[model samples]
Target chain A: MRDAFHEDLDKISDSLVEMTRLVGSAMSRATTALLDSDLGLAEGVIENDVQIDAIRDDIDEMAVQLIAQQQPVATDLRIVVTALHMASSLERMGDLAEHVAKVARLRYPHKAVPPQANATIVEMAQIAERLVAQAGSIIAAKDVDGAEALHADDDEMDRLHRDMFVLLVDEGWEGGTESAIDVTLLARYFERFADHAVSVARQVAYLVTGEWEHKRRVGAPA
Target chain B: MRDAFHEDLDKISDSLVEMTRLVGSAMSRATTALLDSDLGLAEGVIENDVQIDAIRDDIDEMAVQLIAQQQPVATDLRIVVTALHMASSLERMGDLAEHVAKVARLRYPHKAVPPQANATIVEMAQIAERLVAQAGSIIAAKDVDGAEALHADDDEMDRLHRDMFVLLVDEGWEGGTESAIDVTLLARYFERFADHAVSVARQVAYLVTGEWEHKRRVGAPA
Candidate 1:
């Protein structure tokens, strides 16, 4: 019974890691869709979210069953619970990606702001996507050190977020009302996506270290 | 041994509910501070955050100990895992309230936008606070029906958020760039606060039903 439970648990973790990969790809594609104003790609992301949700449900069911049947103890229990939390975070990341795609669909054909403003957004997106990917890798490898490194990526995204805000304000001052509003919304979306990625990294850190990192003060690096 | 473990679990759940109350009050006070431009209240919210974080840590440690020592089975295990998820969500809710307070501090003494816009924000804040408070009540009472009722409150928040966006854009066309930017950031903060409240509600639902709620579609009523 115990061995069978272990196999079931492993399968659940495998599904969670797969879901994380899908979400990471969805986010990367969403960013590309935004930059290129490709409504088709955005629509594809929106449509693919059902699969992510289905995986989340399957994991939850498996985890609950494991606890009910095998009655996990200590590290095994932590592993199951962590998988559930990670699944939720991954699903939220997917939702944020879909939100980005929706914005792309809404404001297509016209760049939200000047090309320079978008450059910062693109940079933040890259960092966020990489963080998500690295988080999945760390979970798969159970590498505490690799999970810790994800915070630096979050710091980079934070710096880019601040720069985006400053640029938006400067553009507003320079009489770019329409473009500035678009830029502000776009920047906010990317900042939120980064926040969710930080959330994923924090969960991974918790799973490995059993410690929750402090929420970094805005001015400081994570 | 089992009786002692159950008693300890009860105590931990009580503490989790208490922490939820602290976070809900923090959010309410922060919103009022924003609307009144009361720096003292905003500062008070920031200062009280230490207590919230301390409660979070205490609950986390207790949960970990319960899982390690008690080795709870099935429903009991779910309770422990749920507590961990709840603590994390409450911590994030506190951070969101702090973010709102920071905005209050930044735009202090000079009402960044008009009173009308401020009123809308205050409404959003009130709804968010109520939803969080209800989440705490549901957890404390174990009332699934109460949680379901609060579920619809997120829809109200969504509608108000859309209205705020429209107001911001329209104001940009009429009230000039500065007001538009202020409204834009303010909208983002309120929208995020609502999102956190939705998260709290989802956690409550999970605790009651042992399942995840689907992500509410953007622009759809709750």
Candidate 2:
């Protein structure tokens, strides 16, 4: 029933949904790798990121082809354009996961996150995994309400990000500078992962609702 | 002399060049604020980022409008899409600079970079500034060679990043945990800034040469 142009768009959308799965899987396994110091799992996350990047390239190519052939104006054009931006955000999310896995890999034979920060790191990873999964749902259904709901989880992620610093700066902390550096970068990777997810959700909302919220929400860069 | 489509694209290109200036200035000032502990200078960089972000939004709008109106295909379409991506990278470079400023602000009345790491941070900032300035020139001229030259600076940035980590973990280091956290984050903000500059340069090369490099070169997250 779908025309060629719509069919191409559909394929692009499906590929995007697949990206969410790959990125989500990468982050979940990367987190486990971080917590357990699983070198194999960490290596897997880093190695598989090329797949995510490849999908992004394919989506960009498809979107450009659609634009050139169909010349769809107004809403159709906006969707394609917004999809390009979304693909970049998702690719960056994969990179963040790869970054987390690198930390795990770099610390092989030792836990990247110290015991004091263990519970917080676990919670951060859980929220990150959920956010990306929701991002996938938001894209599949084009659900603006679902996109808006991502805000609460992102807020929770930010809270955890701040709480992480509190633990790092606590006087009783004894993780040493190396573990502290690891935790600082690790927390940022998780926090940035959530930020990118929220960014993807916002782009979805923009297209679905046709309103661009240009408000900047980046509290602090890692 | 130029048709309306090329004229519109010329405007977008001009805006992109302007972005490089604003972003480069922000990073330069942010580094100063970080090293000198100048709260006022840091605040200025933080406030001026909105200007950088605004230009990116304007460029995106212009690019989208150009695509819709002109219906460009092939090389033309690719160029417009690449501009959109370059805009995002430049905007992120601004945010990274702002992140550096926030680190300085957070450590007000106390220095953010300990003396041991100060020289490397300064060198990193200098390279970040040069890369963005060159990014601007590359955009203005579409100089593929200039874009290619950015790799050397980025390689140096990476080497400094690795060097910073070595300093953090050294047994003789005495910057304390808080200072280490500050330096860790500050070092990462600088490193990511250069990465984005490299990313922007790569986009220019992609459009000019009609060749996209599928290589993955992210050394680490932080």
Model 1 off-target regions past 4 Å? A1-13, A68-72, A109-116, A171-179, A202-206, A209-222, B1-9, B66-72, B171-179, B195-206, B209-222
Write the residue-wise lDDT of candidate 1 on B1-222 in tens digits: 449777887778688788778888998888778778899999999888878777876776687667667766666666566667677667767877887787788889966667657777877878887877777777788665565576567788778878876776663455456666667766666666666655655565555554433322211110
Per-residue alpha-carbon lDDT of candidate 2 for residues B133-203, written as tens digits (9 for 90 to 100): 98899989988667678878989999999999999999878788888899998888888888888778767
lDDT of 1 by residue, A66-95 (tens): 776776565666656666767766777787
Clashes of each: 1, 0
**Candidate 2 — which pairs collide?**
none
Taking all chains together, the TM-score of candidate 1 against the true structure is 0.81
Measured by TM-score, the strongest candidate is: 2
DockQ of each: 0.34, 0.62
Query: What residue pairs clash in candidate 1, if any at all?
Result: B155-B222
What TM-score does the predicted chain A of each candidate obtain versus native chain A?
Answer: 0.84, 0.92
